[model samples]
Target: MIGIADYLDKQLRDYGIKEDLSILDFGCGQGNYTIPIAQIVGGNGKVYVIDKDKTKLNQLLVIAKKVKVDKTIEILESEGQFDFDLSSESVDLVMLFNVSCCIIGQDNYPEFQKLIHELHRLTKKDGKLIIGIKEGKTMLNRVETGIPLISKEFKLDKKEKGKYLDGEKLRNGIFYSLTKK
Candidate 1:
């Protein structure tokens, strides 16, 4: 039932990122996976979790306090628009977990391009972008459209589909990771 979070944590640990590494979870919903990441990064690291919905973030703040890791999370309310207030080349790792399509929607809106550009702008040269989109979604379409908006922004390293069991059933999802190149 909790396969996604476990799998994501395993993948992140396998990468051998530093404990003090700065991470950003874009469109983090309810801090499900974000909390685990925050725990792994430890007190020395800074994990910035952003969601467009302020109420969801408020709930996460409460949960974070309960877990006593609230200090590590810089929860912020941000609209999924181009005007994301962040300095360039700042973050080391950015996780776009099931969040990109949710933010831009399926109307072929150019904001997807702006989002990718902003993420790229906020990433260091060696930063990695980890994205997990649903099986049937607009991420691929957004990728097609995003090419022209920001040339050489990011390169898709690998993508795969797998089933994680959920209550005696199989729940399928697609996972993809990219790096700024």
Candidate 2:
């Protein structure tokens, strides 16, 4: 968790995720990134986290409580569906770090499209999306090198390669920042 916060604080700053901005951590698994996000965003900023794994969500809450960031963190439990409860153009940043294969990869392309469309709908016009993909993900091997085909709804503004938390250990990966088109 220590390295995660330091990494996120530096990475998120590039995306304008300072205090008082709203963020939605979609597909937030076990909240390895959520706790650090909560701290970075602080009390005024809201971190809305969504994950289908109830058990992991619960564990995240316990961790948040220990960090005294539970009040700033909001959980949106999913039912293995992309139908989120957030409103359109409501969030300043969408954190898709450590996303699952179900929403990415060639085989899950349809689901990937749906996920992007939904995330696009939820992101503010000026909001930024940061998606991190580890090596070996199906999409990472795509002809475009895992770059999403999102030019229609979002514009790929920046790409970064650095160390990110994959579960707990730090791993080198690529992440992109996309702004709504």
Candidate 3:
């Protein structure tokens, strides 16, 4: 069985993530994708992980150390807001995998657009924003509304079908790559 990390590594490669690039793993949970990304970017790169849960952030750091990629990772505990303490256009890639829906709720569609704008602000010119959404009608519906806002700052590069291990079951998902205009 392909594990979540392996699955995420494949997806990152498909998105053209390479060595020496800085990355922001927004809403990074337990270092699933974050660790693989650190490996891919190698020692010359940096992976900044942000999550609301401090415990999860600690877990991520532990995994990074276990994998010997701790030096390449920088972590921050977010307060469930869009404020990121980083300079504009400083990162080469922003991974919003499985984080869109959680950050954007049904009652706050406007806030979703604002977050997209913030993501755009954080991304370097021509940098990539890779969004991964779980394959389901409800999740799709929730994210569809923000497409236009994303389109305003990014060009739709491509979309691919992928799978992620959710608990014990592998769930299908869509990965959207958008390049900053």
Candidate 4:
């Protein structure tokens, strides 16, 4: 049986997460994508993972060390808000997979959009941003309303059928690859 990390790393490579690129996994929880992405990016690259949850951050650190990819990652703790201290336009890729889809409802959509705008600040002029939204035709806060606000902050470069990390499983979702406009 394929473990969750192995499965996710394969999915990430298939989705074209390249090597030697600095990345930010915002709201990173428990090293799901953080560990695999760190491995993919290798020794020359870095994955800056930020999460408000201490437990999750600690768990992720443990996993990273166990996987021998801890050197490629820089773990950070936040106050569970939109604010960040990273320098502007520092990373090659920014990933918000499975982070925005949950809280974006009929209301507070603006707040979610604000987060996207902040991401825009963190992305390099030629860098890419990736998001994974759950598959749905009618838009349960995933398809319809989410993209427009994000479009304001990023240009849709490409999209691929991919899985987002959900707990110990990889769930069905679409990965949107966007670049600055």
**What TM-score would each prediction reach against the true structure?**
0.82, 0.89, 0.92, 0.86
For model 4, where is the 10-residue window of minimal lDDT? 136-145
Residue-level lDDT for 100 in candidate 3: 90
Whose TM-score is greatest here?
3
Stretches off by above 4 angstroms in model 1 are 1-5, 15-18, 137-151, 163-170
Which ranges of candidate 4 are over 4 A from the true structure? 1-7, 136-140
Global lDDT scores for all candidate models: 0.72, 0.78, 0.83, 0.79
Which residue pairs in candidate 3 collide? Answer: none
lDDT of 4 by residue, 1-181 (tens): 9777777878777656779989999878787788889989999999998888899999998989999999999865588777688889888888877666554755568778888787788888877887777777643445456777778678887877766777766777877788876
Badly placed stretches (over 4 Å) of model 2 are: 1-4, 137-139, 142-148
RMSD of 3: 1.8
Model 1 residue-pair collision total: 0
Instruction: Name the runs in model 3 displaced over 4 angstroms.
Output: 1-6
Rank order by TM-score, top first? 3, 2, 4, 1
Instruction: Please report the TM-score between candidate 1 and the true structure.
Output: 0.82
**Residue lDDT tens for model 1, 1-181:** 6566676577667544458888888888777666777888889998888888888888888889999889989965577555567778878998877676675576554677778778898889978887666666456676445444544788777767754233334467566667887
Winning model by lDDT: 3
| Number of colliding residue pairs in each model | 0, 0, 0, 0
